[model samples]
Target: MILTVHHVTTYEYDAPMRGAVQSLRLFPSRFDGQRTIRWDVAVEGGLRGGNFRDGAGDKVEGWSLRGPVSEVTISAIGQVETTDTAGVLRGHREIVSPFAYLRETSATWIDHALRDLAETAVTGVKEPLDRAHRLSRAVSDAIAYRPGTTHAHTTAAEALAQGEGVCQDHAQALIACARAVGMPARYVSGYLFAREDGAPHEAAHAWAEIWVENIGWIGFDPANECCPDARYIRIGSGLDAHEAAPIKGIAQGDGSERLDVTVALEAVQQ
Candidate 1:
């Protein structure tokens, strides 16, 4: 399947000040099941800077905008060909050790409730792969998918206790649970080509991937209760959402900032 993606982000400042800088991870991933056909990223009134692929296999580019600028717009347009690998992240080159993801983040720190949840979900399961699947399902069952219930800083333990959140919360919670049970897991961020019954979010999507001994990192979206397939486009990943965000930047100014993002994805014509 071929998927086309368009993502646009705009930042409006209350007052124009001095400068701004951004790190972009807006390119698609190059892997066996996913191929980048064509891609482009542009920033209005911004200067492009250093760009490179990180050890985690994500493309990073820097951008700088100068002066009393009140607004900056970033746009990404691309096409990618993808094949279903049952959510297995095969043929992706990343030298980072899977164990590196075991360390917890502030957003994924495990508490007593999280530890108990992880333990209860994987009890009596010996196989690591099965344990992961069961845990993903357990998270989906525990957290209801409701928008606006949780905020960006909401931790996994807090989300679990609240029992409702968006995809980010689900992904973070799953990562926390997987790590608690001794399975290396990371967060994945990318576009999902939505169908009538698919990808149910208004913006970009996120999921969790756990390391299966021989399989490497296998994607799991507990919010959707399935593995990623051809409809999913691989972009970049990190220990959690903040690290994997498509765009991260700081605007040096006395002005407050307002961010608006719009994303559109669809299947290309055969």
Candidate 2:
């Protein structure tokens, strides 16, 4: 399938601030499943700086805005052809060892409750792939997809306890659960074309990736209860959502900041 994407993010501040700098990880991942046809990024009134592919094989770019600015906009326009890899990340060039993801972040810390949940989810599962599927299903059943119930700082344990969260929470919970079962897992950020109700879900999306001994890394969306296929576009990953954030920045001055994001994605029949 060929997919076209247009995304824009705008930051508005109540009080005019000084300088600002941002690290953007908005580029799509290079893998056997996907190929970028055309991609462009623009920063309003900002200077572009050095950019390079990180060890994880995701392109990271830097941008800076000068003083006395109240708003900054970042936009991306691109098209990509994707194949269904059944969630298996194949032929992706990355030097980072998968074992490194074993370590848990604060957002995905596996506490006693999480450990029990993970253990119970795969009670009879013995194989790695089957275990992963069971864990994903268990998490999906455990949490209700309810936005605004959890914030950016909400942890996996917190989300599980509340039994309500968004995609980020589900991803973090899956990571925590997978790690609890002695599997290596990390957070994935990208785009999903459809929601459970078949609505447009293609925007800033998050999921989990688990590393199997012989199968490599596989993407799983516990929130959506499915594996990534042709409809998914992976961008980058991290130990958790905070690390894999699409945009990370430091503003020189700020009283309060509000952000708005818009995305457009559609299929191009080929």
What would you estimate as the lDDT of candidate 2? 0.91
Write model 2 residue lDDT over 105-148, tens digit each, in one string: 88999888889989998898899999999899989999998978
lDDT score, residue 41, model 1? 97
- TM-score of model 1 vs. true structure: 0.97
* Model 2: lDDT of residue 251: 83
The count of residue-pair clashes in candidate 2 stands at: 0
Q: After superposition, how far is residue 97 of candidate 2 from its true place, in Å?
A: 1.0
lDDT at position 88, candidate 1: 91
lDDT of 2 at 243: 95
lDDT of 1 by residue, 167-226 (tens): 899999999999999999999998777622654665488999999887789999987888
